[model samples]
Target: MTKVTAQLSVSLDGFYAGPRHDGDGDWMASAESHGFFRVTRWVTEAMSWRERQGFAGGRQDVNSEIVAESFDAAGAYVMGRRMADGGEVPWGDEPPFRAPVFVVTHRPRERLVRQGGTSFTYVTDGVESAVAQARAAAGGKDVAVAGGGSLVRQVLRAGLLDELELHVVPVVLGTGMRLFDADLGLDEFEGIELTPTRVVPDPQVTHLRYTVHDRTPLTLDDRGAGTEKA
Candidate 1:
């Protein structure tokens, strides 16, 4: 079966990117300067990442192997409009994805064909629609949710995410956009369960993979609230 997977690199404090400021100029450049670069340094230094970006040399360690594995597993991708816009110029003519990318947005736009096998198809409806389109395009491989926190949260809340991988870096950003924020609305429910499937410890970062479980509701009685299995 084709699984829906998501991967992200975060700081020790659970922040994926630094806090956004008004008039911060270019969002991408500002994020890099704030702490995005520090959080994702491991990925940037990976040989697989460098090769995908058309760069020559990089470290070919365990981290590089992990990066390569992720690239190989994903056949299609779903991302938010903001992420796509921010990455458009940086990704250049031939983006590393090399597969069909579904962008969830409110605006409607024609399909964008790029160099290599990469192409962008804008989905105007919602995240579910984007994921459905990606699943159809995956060709038996897994669909990756390439995100910017909010999109990932939406997928998680909608119970569409199957697997999640977090790359925990050593550095700590005092203030930034947290992956698991109050906006997630998970606090109201019993919360989703995650079964740790894999753990890879490295010098630069630690990779943790988890299998997401369906949320189980809390059993309420005359006395108090208790837990119950799904």
Candidate 2:
């Protein structure tokens, strides 16, 4: 089965986006205005995905490669209603997804077909159902949870996510939307059961990959013993 994965760019202090991001164009403007864009510069500055939206310059370096790999891994996407609505501004008529996107929302709307291969299907049935629909639409490829924070938290809390890739930026947005700001008591889970599988260091950000297993991961001593030469 294709892994249900999520990728997000978060600040060192755990903020994803700054406050006041209610589908307004300001969210994508200068960082001085929308602190969210400041943290997300890693993705927006390097990825060719920005070019698809009529942006001028983008990188082809390590960061861009990482971004490209993430894009290639997804056959379908699941995002919250805010992400879908917020994206319409910067994304124009042909959003960069270029694949089927299932949006989780309380308000249902007709399927929206955009230019390029992107299509938006609203789901009022919640995260699991949205994920199910995204996976089916994805065929055999991975269903990527492209987030706006709240939806990502919901999926994590539900234990539906198989992998979580966090691009940890160095900056700290003191007050903003946080990935673990929900009332789920995530403090009780981090570094205990959520095991880090890989860590790729970059100049601008660090890519931290974790696998969500049913039980806690091995301790340092256990891992050392498992790697001993026979």
Candidate 3:
């Protein structure tokens, strides 16, 4: 069965991106200056990541293997419009993701066909629709929710995410874009649970994988109290 999975590199303080700026100039500069690169430095230094980006020479350690494994597991991807737009220039003609990518956005645009197997399909409806399309396109492989925080939160809140992989770096950013800044709006009766599946420790980063389990809401009694039925 195809599973919905998400991966992100976060700071020790739980920030994926740096602080938001007011104007485009400030934002662009801040994006570069902030802890964004620091948090993702591990992957950027990996041989697998370097190879995908058509670069030369990187470390072929455990981190590289993990990166390769993630890329191999994902057959299709779903991401937010902001992330897609931001990556367009950096990713160039041959994007790292060599699979069909569904972009969740309000504005409708024609499908973008790139070099290799990468193609961007803009989804105007919602995240759920995007994930559904990605799953269908995955061809029995896992659907990767490549995100910019908000998209990941939306998928998790909607109970569409099946697995989550967090690359926790040691450095702490005092102020930045937190991965869980907003409420997930989980069930009041029975909140969601994450079962730890794997953990890979490294000097620069710690890789943690969890299987998301949405628990059944508890039964309510006559007095509106929560109860578990026998």
User: TM-score: which candidate is best?
Assistant: 1
Query: Candidate 3: lDDT of 73?
Result: 93
Instruction: Please list all clashing residue pairs in model 2, or write none if there are none.
Output: none
Clashes of each: 0, 0, 0
Q: Tens digits of per-residue lDDT for model 3 on 1-230?
A: 99999999999999988885545685557853467888999999999999999999999999999999999999999998988988999899999999999999999999999998999999999998999999999999999999888999999989999999999999978888888865787656776778999999999899999999986677766884566565
Q: Which ten residues in a row have the lowest lDDT in candidate 3?
A: 20-29
TM per model? 0.91, 0.85, 0.90
For model 2, residues 42-70, the per-residue Cα lDDT tens digits are 88888465665677888878888888888
**Any runs in candidate 2 off by more than 4 Å, and if so which?**
22-33, 185-192, 215-230
Give each model's whole-structure lDDT: 0.91, 0.82, 0.91
What's the C-alpha lDDT at position 35 in model 3?
A: 74
Show model 3 residue runs off by greater than 4 Å: 26-28, 31-33, 187-190, 215-230
What is the C-alpha RMSD, rounded to one decimal, of candidate 3? 5.0
- Arrange candidates by TM-score, descending: 1, 3, 2
